[model samples]
Target: MRIDLHTHSTRSDGTDAPGDLVRKAKLEGLDAIALTDHDATEGWDEAQAAADEVGLRLIRGIEISTQFEGLSVHLLGYEFDPTHEPLVQELGRVLGGRNDRLPRLLDKLAGLGMPLTEQDVLAGARDAAAWGRPHVADAMIAKGYIKDRDEAFRDWLVPGKPAYVGRYSADLFEAVRLVCQAGGKPVIAHAWARDSGTKITPELLAELTEAGLAGLEIDHPDHDARDRAALAAIADDLGLAKTGSSDHHGTGKGPAFHLGANLTDPAELERLLA
Candidate 1:
């Protein structure tokens, strides 16, 4: 069975709505797909309904924003009770931080002479449960400020860029603990991508394994062959399940990713689900 465990929808920064995302996944011939919208599970019900209709196994998940040693990280939580109080509260705070940072980001953009209004950004966000840099980048695209999301980030949204702004994220160890408390499997998403890899050393992975982190998203568009091999070795040493996914964000994420561009092993899926 083909399974792609990381994806997004309009409930977060993806270009497709929840139902549409599922339908597209079905069309792409995916046997199973996870809706891992950033910081929110609002899309789960609709995506699940669509998955049921299409006979696709749905993995309800959230890509939580987290921090470790002052660096940003993403934690993927799967099969958790969405109503769990502590997890819900933390996600709310993280979404709040996303909301709070918008004006500052826009202000920075304005300073750079690419002023984009709140209405423009909101319009770009469509029905997203959480607004973030990708939505802002969409707004920029609408205004002809950039060609696509990658350019938007390269030019402004990435760390140390002129329009970049910091926001709140759960502490990494605390995030893993909360996911476990919520009865979900916690995996570090794209753990060794870009500069974030510096913060996710083997030593740290071992520590997180001790903290109940169940897996590592070793196969991702951002992880090259060498990166995946190294991460897989660490997962083996730590006895963590290794997951692979496209991290699909729809067309907005460019051609680098497609549904099932990368897939998790069926055995690994069982391990994660177990």
Candidate 2:
């Protein structure tokens, strides 16, 4: 099966609606796709319904915001029950931290004289705190705050950049345990990039593997072939499953990546299903 295991929808930072994403996957000849929305499983119902319509298999998933050693560690949860309460509670905690920290970020920016506000981000957000910088970037772009997301992050959004806020209270090990309790396999998202810095060391990988990490996202838009090779080797040495995908988020993301373009095959889907 043509499976794109990693992707987003408006339920998180992605521009497409849940059902629309399924339709787009169908158009791209994808046999299976996972609705790995960031920090929430709210899109699964709509995604499943849409997948039914398009005859595409929708793997229920979530991209959780977690941490290890004060660095952001995005955990991908796959093949879990949507109604799983433990997962629900933990996601709520993670997102609640997200909500709380974002405002603190706004407050920090204001103190720094940037004058950015949560209201600015919320106006563009589809709902609650499920979205982040992208919405702010779009609003900034719309209001001419910055040229695009790249400029937005470089100028105002990325960590250590002006107007950035730190998100604390993210316990990555607990997130892995929660996904395991929810019957989902948790995978560490894109590492080996300059952005991750010291976060992707062998020791860190070992710690996460011991903490119940099931896989590593070796294929991604940011990872070069050499990086992927290093990650794949690490996954093998550590006995973690190796996975790949284009983290598609519609037109908002740059070119050369979209649904099914860079994908994990059916065999991997079968492995995930198992």
Candidate 3:
């Protein structure tokens, strides 16, 4: 009954293909895995087919980029109707933003004396639905400008860095409502990570619960013990399902993000999908 509820594939920032990610998850002893590619549902069918072939349960999901109080927040939506018009339209805008920012990102990098063509970045994107920072990082890696995604972000791509470029993101509250409207369960992904948790107070959590937030991700590689404890308590108070996941990004992330490094309890999975 082991389930890891968040991961990515070549459809987004992760290195693995949809089917490869599924096969790897099966080999890692995961009974269930969710393909939560960033803002895209293109990987769902392929991942689902692979999961079926491997005798694994697949939870179709997306890790939507959203903004809350001027901070970036990721929302995980599961089992949604991918064709829901409004949701689909919103995803299109997000993907468009990702694509639209590529040239600007490259321009910034070129200004910093590291010129790259769109083809260079696209070469790393593979089957990705859109271009993103990770693909840019991969391009940088290819140019030997950085060793990995970590160094790339630390030096150039992250906010306040020279290569940083702003992009459109959905409003968090609206995103939650949209996911619910699309017949999906919406959960905050790694709610306590990257100092975003400091803004998600109990009062805000209560408000989001009313706004159709179904769960909170409590176990993640980025969350320490204290953060998990506090988030768990808040989730308990709000009657929200508590989720755990590896947040696997294939080789795009560190070893701590290995598949099934963190897992959701079966009962919690039931609660989340209820």
* Steric collisions counted per model: 0, 0, 0
In candidate 1, position 221 carries an lDDT of 90
Candidate 3 residue runs with Cα over 4 Å from true position: 195-199
* Residue 236 in model 2: lDDT: 87
Candidate ranking under TM-score, highest first, comes to: 1, 3, 2
Q: Which residue pairs show backbone clashes in model 2? A: none
lDDT of each: 0.91, 0.78, 0.93
lDDT of 2 by residue, 201-264 (tens): 8888898889888888888887888888888899889988878887888866887567776777
Please tell me which predicted candidate would have the highest lDDT against the true structure: 3
Query: If scored against the real structure, what TM-score would every candidate get?
Result: 0.98, 0.91, 0.98
Off by over 4 Å in 1: 195-199
Candidate 1 deviation (Cα RMSD): 1.0
TM-score of 1: 0.98
lDDT of 3: 0.93
Sort by lDDT, top down from the best: 3, 1, 2
Per-residue lDDT for 1-274 in model 1, tens only?
A: 9999999999899989999999999999999999999999999999999999999999999999999888788999999989999989999999999999999999999999999899999998888877899999999988998898889888788887788899999999999999999999999999888644364789988999999999999899989899899999999999999999999998878666788999999999999889
Q: Candidate 3 residues 1-274, lDDT tens each?
A: 9999999999999999999999999999999999999999999999989998999999999999999878788999999899999999999999999999999989999999999999999999999999999999999999988899989887778777778999999999999999999999999988778634355677877998999999999999989999899999999999999999999998899899999999999999998899
Cα RMSD, each candidate? 1.0, 2.1, 1.1
